[model samples]
Target: MSVTAVGAFTDEQLELRKTVRALLAKHADPAAVRKAAESERGYDAALWELLCQQVGVAALAIPEEFGGIGATAVETHVVFEELGRTLAPTPMLGSVVLAAQAILASGDTDACERLLPGIAEGTSVAALCWTGAEGSWDTDNVGVTAQGDVLTGSSHFVLDGSYADVLVVAAAVDGVVALFEVDPAQDAVTRRRVPTMDPTRTLAVVEFAGATGRLLTSDGAAALERVREIACVALSAEQVGAAEQALANTVEYSKSRVQFGRPIGSFQALKHRMADLYFLVETARSASYAAVASLAEASESAASDAAVAKVYCSEALQSVTGDSIQLHGGIAITWEHDAQLFFKRAHGSAQLFGQPRAYLTSMKSAAGLTA
Candidate 1:
């Protein structure tokens, strides 16, 4: 949705989005992005420093008392939408959506104080360690066990886990949801990279064998449930941005490429398709905003709303990004074009936390469906 249409972004929020867009335009060049995605680091550290140290995007979600902008969920959503447009290889989502949110939501003052500043300033990177074969976000799926503050068991598909200095792991201790802070350097932990469709965003299989960990919180299953809902909201925002970008690229390419005697964009069939793509993107954006607003309200129905947004947005993004590639014809299939990058990102992001089908099922159950 356009800033003008949203009508909710204050001048400051608009300005922040503009600034991030311009920064990405300048720094995340096509070549640079390709290189970062292929690199071992999985993201650009220098670009991350510029965002955290210079531009202050990383600090936007942190509370003002904790050395951040203290922006609300809606404002944070704007920032993530801009970030996704660039496909900037950074850990903004992992840090803010997973780590920072867990610490803040846990009501652990010591942990927040110890970790927030570093996360805000780009000195520290953290990953959310949860996900298994079913790729479930439910508390029971958390097989990693915490015993007397020590954590053990394996967490698969930990985003950014390979490079993070700290890991916020969700585990079950006698069926009670537990949070633990794991140091990657410790001897008890081992991390192996998982090759993914989108290399820019890293994933890893982390094994915690009697890993020494600091207890972050023990609020039972409720803590993990809340964190999962928050993650769904943030992810939906990113998918909206990805879908929008893919559509924009297709439009730009259609206008520039000539077919028959004129630009392909002038063709009636192509124009209608692009128009439909635009509508889908806008609908996804609206759904995403609704999710963010509901999350901010923390309503009783927020979880269901977030799940609906996630499922719808993921499906929309998959459709839009695929059509974006197809609309570009053979050129989109080549490695030189950026269309493939977005297509892969869309595919990968769809499975993060859980895929569209999983969310759809969860949403149905949340609505009290018997079948």
Candidate 2:
């Protein structure tokens, strides 16, 4: 199904998409992007400000009462799609969508009041530190232990961990898994950047040695689960945008590059492959929109829909990005080629939130079937 068939985007959302694309076109071009990647922060501060202040992309889904645009999931879908299309480097995924959603879904007004405004205004960067060494989302996999208001243990690969001003961690308190808020600068807190396959996104390992923790909720397992589902949907939307662009670039390159006195794309085999990729892209797009719609309606199948979208997008992106490199041939293997960047992001994003296999299991569990 096409996006229009479902009426997924409001007129306002479409306007937002155009505005964000225009802004990214100006700021996120290849040369400018390479400069940002080499910077210490791994992103452009000025461009991030433009996105948060002028575009209000960070605040789109945040409620106005808490200093945001108070938009819906559909708006988020459009914004995420634009972000992925350009591979725009920003912390919106870690700060606004994932961690902020965890707080909001917990129904903790106090936490939102204290933490959300900074996120909405783009001043504070937050990340959720949930999975540990094992990289499992199951509550039982939580390695951090919270006793009273102090937390102990270590978390690995926390999103935006190296740059996060505030960290929302899932820790067991009183033998119940709960969400705890921590200040990264606390004396007992230790954080270091962990090398990542994709430098566009930062990750860090943080250890708490009896660090002070403020409990967001005594029972936040469900809230984290909900955030995980919605986050996968958001990332899937991004994967679609990125994959779509990769395919477009390949097609353009094929038309211009000649081989054997003919354009490579003119060949039957290459044309057939590109056709398959287009079909994959469209399937992913449909699944992404369906997931967004289900979540927006608060439907019973939201989890299942998100799972399906996440799994399909992950697999599609792998094929799309790999084929992008294959079609580009030798030039693509060079470090400076944009194809390498998309391929790297594809591999990185495939495992974000959870892998396709994990989401497949979630789909089964959601459907009351044995995984």
Candidate 3:
């Protein structure tokens, strides 16, 4: 599919982005982010409530009937980008985007009606337990299995899994993948928080021992694929935003940080590097915007756009953050500086959903380019 220019943002979208940015600037500064990341819930509950109540961020993509703002992925993209800029740890990605989209894709009206309200309001958390220990996110590699209503086995790398009120699982059943809703509070269910390189995000391992689940969809491979595509697109926006912010911070530092006689950023070599980073950030932003546009429009090229956005944005963010560290010198690696946090976020996000190599391989296979 040929890449296209992103559509101009509507007035509301621009305003929404401004509102979210302002909120994050006020509430999720670097110190606040660090504090939240170290907290028990791994996020700022008060800020999350503010975002939900004021901006209606969690409700942006849900339909009106589901008690949402009846907006599109573009709106969610706006919010995700702002959240990425601050590396604010929140359930918006895992619960609002991943699990909510998975439930919507299941085409279970009753399930949507039952589950989406709390998610829309940011009052409840939901997690999608799909991948295994390998974190491949492949439909065929789903870790859990279902026999009748009972689920067994464990899923890893589950976002917000340790504290989610609802668990939407993709499990193998009779040789096919299906979606099941499991209550995390059930006696048969166990959740454990896992350590991660990125302190700004939370992941968990959920094990089910003959846990009873309510079937959402009997055939869920297609739904799972759809959710993955949407997730890739959404994540791409975050990567772009983070990359842009990283570059901005580096540039600002270059202007202020003096060397022997002048600012380090005034040096020709540093200027060139920053220029290259700028190019990467701009291109990645374009790719992310196009992907979100395609998804919002339900365009035929949405899947391919998502793939391109995921791979390109991941690489761009990683490259930007890596250079950011080098430019910032030893201070970048110190615990007191924010550069290290950006670097960690880049690496962690590159591995989230799936690695860039994984997406490239899938794209090549889909295009019949595989040997």
lDDT of each: 0.81, 0.86, 0.92
Ranking by lDDT: 3, 2, 1
lDDT of 3 by residue, 256-295 (tens): 9999989999899999989999999999999998898888
Q: How do these models rank on TM-score, best leading?
A: 3, 2, 1
**lDDT tens readout by residue for model 2, 255-320:** 999999999999999999999999999999998988888888788888888888888998898899
lDDT per residue as tens, model 1, 221-303: 56677777888888888889888988988998899999898999999999999999999998888878878877776667778
Model 3 CA lDDT for position 241: 85
> Highest TM-score: which candidate?
3
TM-scores vs. true structure, each candidate: 0.94, 0.96, 0.98
Estimate the overall C-alpha local distance difference test score of candidate 1.
0.81
- lDDT winner, 2 or 3: 3
Query: Which portions of model 1 miss their true places by more than 4 Å?
Result: 1-7
Model 3 C-alpha RMSD vs. true structure (Å) is 2.0
lDDT, candidate 2, at 232: 87
Alpha-carbon runs more than 4 Å astray in model 3: 1-4
Backbone clash total for model 2 is: 0
